[model samples]
Target: MPNQNDSDSNIHALLIGIDNYSSTSLFKSLEGAVRDINLVEAFLKNTLKLPTERIRRLIAPNREDTVLLVARSAHEPEPTYENIVKAFTELTEAAQPGEQIYIHYSGHGGRATTIYSDLKGEGQSDEGIVPMDIGQPDGRYLRDVELATLLKRMTDKGLVVTVILDSCHSGGTTRGDYAIRSSGETDTAIRPRESLVGSREELINNWRSLTEGIHRTAWIPVSRDYVVLAACRPTESAYEYSVNGKERHGALTYWMLDTLNTLPGTLTYKALHDRVGAKIQSKFPSQLPMLLGEGDRAIFGTNRISTHYTVTVLQVNASQQRVKLNAGLANGLDSGTRFAIFPFNTADFANKQKQVAIVEVTDIEASSATARVLAEVEGGIGVKGQIEPGAPALLLAAPTDLVRRVRFHDQKQLGEAENELPTQALVDQQKEALDAVRQALAGNGWVMEVQPGEEGHYQVALGKNGEYEICIGMPIKNLNPPLMFRDAAAPREVVQRLVHLTKYQSVQELDNPASELMDALEFILLDQNKQPFPNPSNITLKHGTKAYLRVKNTASQALNVAVLDLEPTWQISQIPLRGNNAAFYELAPQETADIPLRFTAPEGAAYQQAKEMLKLFATRGAADFRWLRLPPLDHVIEKQHEATRGIQSAFGKLLEAVGTEPNAAPVMTRAAVYEPDPNADWVTKQIQVTIVPESLLPD
Candidate 1:
């Protein structure tokens, strides 16, 4: 066994194992409960090195046949509801903040239900654990909700607790049944008709689950503190099997202790879970152990990663913009660590959260590090007027309007003779076309001028894209025909769409970080408590509670932020501003916009829309969606094409009326560029968040 080596530590454990039940009860005897408990005790006492005195045991009464009898001392609590509750109460009173604790349960687990008709939103009777003496009404089963209530007390006291359950409820085990396939979860327990060892002449049995009434729903507590290791999903039953030369034990319990003994204090909760789960599934193939809990916690109270520490407020060098953290090397941290600051005091694990700013460690001492802010998440439109209703940010006059300067690249010369006038007249005609296109765009707020690479932030480039007209249907077919935008694709709109697509794709290639211009900006989604999901791609929701979207701005300039989401059904919609106020955000420099993302719907309807992929676009200036008033992307592109064609036609007739070559070849303009912002540039990023269904949540 690996040694933990920590002799002086404030850690406590409660280990419960019950192998016996009243003969009158519906449950059968189990052969592995005592074995599982004994092995776990060895793991804590011999391997992890917790003192035997700190380990509390609630086991079945001792008998001569027990194989691990030598491991237990004479003085120990017997498995009883009163004793178990008493241990919890005492721990609640004695445990302190930052104290570590372990809770393990190995025993008969059968589903039971208790009526609470008065409770609101209570759908059915709750699932429970079958306790010893469950045959009597006075010895009620320990229910899931009741257990959650008990666990809540420990969490409320701020003690870090880890729970391991190697048993299943909804009682039926098949250890002694006719041979069957072990491909998936099935009951495997020691259930025999009861017969007294001495005086009882007849073996009789009454099922506990049969009398208790099985419930369709299990009421596990909603908590974030207790790290959990459940034996199997609620849909499946846990099993006890013989392995390693006739050794009998609960599958999960055996694998768990084996891993802990091997890795000891060095294994993390996550790492331990992965190794244990893999072993259980590989050997049993039918059973799957589950790991549920907090982020990056280490096993046996060692090497804890503290992500919750506060920033040191002192600014030793204001010009350098350096800061420090409250924690340092002593807190398992070192230099070069990056920290994200949340504007709010709390974090919600289920909401779409935003980040305020990013800071990196520059120098480290024994307890703290010096950090400098790299960039601010800022998007300000610089519009002074009061914002109209439902728009999150004010719309300033566009940057292109402000710069009134554009660089026009005419690639039309690359096209065929039919695309231009006769060769003799083509030079003058092409020059005239360039002038005409340039003047048309300038009339729409672009002045054909740029200082080398500056380009005034917006450039008008056009060319004949025969590909646009050749052998292709609409690129966006999902849009309704009314919004299909069937007209010729405009030079400005087509160019703008291509530019937007390029920028959007750049941010998505996260592996190539350099391709992103606004890599420093982050939009976070969080649960109600302001804690992020362990897996952002697979978010778990709690009863349709509200989620939050936090924006972290580290840049020095303001910005306009717009978040668009694609539903699981492929519908595209923008995440509206708080209270339908604005379409975009005019965020201040080095500021954060923390808004509760309440999708405008009835309470029930919101939870149904949890599966989504969100695209958050941040621009140096506002990109107004209100003017577009478009539907999904499929329709948006089509309509933009239609509008571009309209503008081109108007410009084409104007060129003819304004006196060009008296009679010239028809101009085949292939593309258009929309000058979205003349004053500023924009960047885009997208992330997928999948909210797991409530029915599937273990707790």
Candidate 2:
């Protein structure tokens, strides 16, 4: 029970070593031997940051590192199982802060059936860890399922527990023994993978009982914290030494400890596996070490001891939307550490292909977090003659089956294959880069020009500096907001922005907020015509302007509105939503309400200082539902065509004023002529239009 908070010197260690039934039924071999246990005990005491003085031993007589359980003979009458259980229980109860309990069992392991007391005749038998007793005809070995449940419960209290299983039993649902083919003879038994790892009911039953008394316990969530190291796959046997005068320890266990002891500094879980697995294979040539746990979680791109990084995409030119990402070093990052940017098409990588476009860094953007630099290319006949940016040119993928050499800036080969070139991968790399460029173009203030080669492929160039160009030949996407003439367009944009958040899987949590705000804003921007204001439905607020919003909750839930990142110039007060059909208060069930917001815009000089804060809030509020794509926008006349009573009554006044100037906002002053019911009184009032205009005209 080592507490995570304890200093390195305060930790404790508990080691167990058992050896009985040497030949057949008993725990046998070097796993339970004095030599193996002693080596493991010394490694724990020295390598681990545990207090040496508190190390408890239960094996050898008078030794503090051993925990020896009373051995039972296979021939003894009523062989005892309580000794091992009692020993484990005592060790578990004695756990305290800075104490780690290590239970290592190395002995003969075999399949054993669990026999319940009720299954036997009257006054027959009870449940226990049975030993192989040659004297008793009715003795059994141990099953992993039974042992796993007991061990899992004993270490339930957030303990820094480590269970090392060095036995030869199939860890999962596989029978280890199978016949091999002799010459051309067919194999006799099914392989381990073809057999049941464990009964689903048995696993469920054990965990259910383990968590029965615990409060608020459920199935374990897959986490990086927990660690498990198995000697081999559940179906394989752990190999022992066969050479004379060689190390007597099991091949897997010996190498596991040797690698840990000799390796300097801390080894990551994956690294440790590779080292230990390779070392054992070199010596025995067939053993592998299974190391599992959360790897060393070093914070990247930071100095503080925290594990989070801020991923920022900075716009070099806001109007042109020429953006470059600046990924800052997170807290706990090793400073000045070299980092390689390995960009691979993730989709292509899944198919076991290395579609990598290496971007070598020639220079670091001193004011930015620019890492990899792309080299430039020019002066080639039959090749596109665009003068691209120098040093930061992309690592171009050449279409060829055999890649002879990839020469970088200094004629150094980035890569060279002996015979075959990666041509398919080159095609995939180009596709991925093109896809990313297309996604970025869907935003405002950006355009792409792809000039196809006369032979094949195309030359790509992005609009640089402040130039804004639109090419009609390119595929048309929803780059501009729809229904820009009415205030209702804000709510429509909000809904569209909601769709944008789903583009990145990392930001799924914002979906609920996006949906809620979209519904709220739709109710306030509509009038008697059920159509948005023709002139300015969606207003683009300047960098300094302040505006108010009104949201009518047309649903049953009490909607909550939270505004983030409005600073000294832009701020919000407590705006509630409840009323039958009010404009700026709480909108009750089936009611509408408005929110009055007032704030000053930052002065010219102070604008850039608050840009990041403003941008982050606006982006979060928009929540990924972008206007690039919409469900569909229909005119109010379409609803009237559907025979809806409300739409017909609302739009009847506009029809009457059709003969008048078409530019005028059609008035609905005639109450009886336009109202769906003469007695039904529901008048809409306008919130103040102080900062934003009364109506916005389309560009």
Candidate 3:
């Protein structure tokens, strides 16, 4: 782990928190923003032992509230548009090379019409933080473009920066008991004179110069010098809730502080993010924290990478031996899922000695679960004392009945005549290959040999020489060409291909008919002119024609959405916002997003019609569905590993279970057990479209 003490002098911070606004009707006063900054300041001074002079504070406190514990300093300036800009300028000019800067903001985020449409590329709106002076003559938002420009100035000077935003870009209304941290959408446009630093023309020219050579349609420019820890997705709301049953605080800020206090000076930003996300989702299932840019870097140091996913132990009942976890059906927990309890600070679960106990899920709710302790280690090495709240429960295993059934076809089944039989040695080789494959799959929990009377999901037929052909069923008549392997293919290689096929099948078969989100989401296919296609289920478009997909969220809650393109060549890839570096497309309640689509025939084929499927996935909380992506069958078989972030280990293990290869050690952190959250109420909707040659069009 990197030592923070060695670089304490090089660290500086700027904390901005706003709870009051000039336009009260437009932006409601928050109860937690002022307190958030106070807590952060306390951490820096008391915990990190940083000098007071190294930290700068700007705040807008509610004047009528006397219950706020932390008294605002008179010297601290309000977080108005001008003061905020001046602070950024001062920090950039004063900070030395190689120093670290931490910027934290807790306020309302808003969206408005973009002032420079040409510079914004395809986006017509700009998202920004609403300053305290907004609604006044000179009041305006500090837009994302302007913020990126400011951060670039700091990074260009060789300084490492980290930004924490406890606000969201969309969603305005409160949900249940939580108050949203958003100012809603605005039609007010920002003028060129509103540039933070330079004149309008200079800022535009500088922004254009900075974005030169980069993808022009990107909503926000990508940068590696800094990382942003956002409270929620762009489509969702950031809430201020009573975290401790007393005072309110931004959910992200509270959980983040809790993680830091428990495991201070020992985590990278990525690890911190994972821990914080788990905790926040436990209470606010609708909010998912986002980590953008250089997530692998150390908290305040230059570079590092590691992550671990675990549910928090919210409570323990000694008499009943039942512990409640901060995860439930919404987090993908089931009745039989098991976990190994570890200390909150345990970074590596590979160390078996650090385990405290083993537990199994007994009951589940929408956002929480109850588990019973099955066994306690004789001695807890890492975490002393008994199990308590906030302990990390690493996934041990999940009980699942999902299996891949395969039927192997003999030469007769392939329609070969007996007189064409090869030499006796060739028959022996074929038998040897079948036995090798069966043996390799024997221990796999996910793959099973089809019984005599049982149906199989896949049929594998051995070729005349030594090649193999795999398809969905026995005949393989009209379906796309069978996934073929060359002669002399190794049994292990063949098994890996089967594993990939299993993954492809599993993703396609994913469904949640009982989910409320299923009805909340609507997927529409559009033609060249952006009009809805008449027959969406049986769509046909000329090759290379302009197409579009519009996703609308009609539910009261926000959703994190993504579009996966299942190509005719049997490859699955994410389509929407591709190459734009967006984490996922967020659709606010009753909001819609449009994604452009283009279809073309396979290479070297002049006139052909191919079928393609588009799958849209939406969840109340954030879920990484990138695990569903697979390379085309014709493409070379390269080993692809899922990201080690959230439920990746769970997904990886599913693939690993049906293979003969030894389990690979995690890259930086131990593998997390995969628990599919049904409570996230995830839903998938797919559309099939047929692409035809342009010459086939009727005059």
Best by lDDT: 3
- In model 2, the runs with Cα more than 4 Å from the true position are 1-10, 23-28, 58-81, 97-99, 114-142, 170-205, 208-225, 242-245, 282-288, 291-699
Q: What does the lDDT come to for candidate 3?
A: 0.66
lDDT of 3 by residue, 565-647 (tens): 77666667666332233334556689866566667655535226777778887765444544346677555322221111111
* Number of the top TM-score candidate: 3
Query: What tens digits encode model 1's per-residue C-alpha lDDT throughout 436-513?
Result: 434334322213355676734343332232212100122322222221112343334433333333223322331212
lDDT by residue for model 2 over 672-692, one digit each (tens)? 664222111111112222122
> For candidate 2, which ten residues in a row score worst on lDDT?
649-658
Report the number of clashing residue pairs per model. 72, 61, 7
> Which TM-score value belongs to model 3?
0.63
**Root-mean-square deviation (CA) per prediction:** 25.6, 26.6, 10.8
After TM-score superposition, the amount by which residue 567's alpha carbon in candidate 2 deviates from its true location, in angstroms, is 35
Candidate-wise lDDT, in order: 0.46, 0.30, 0.66
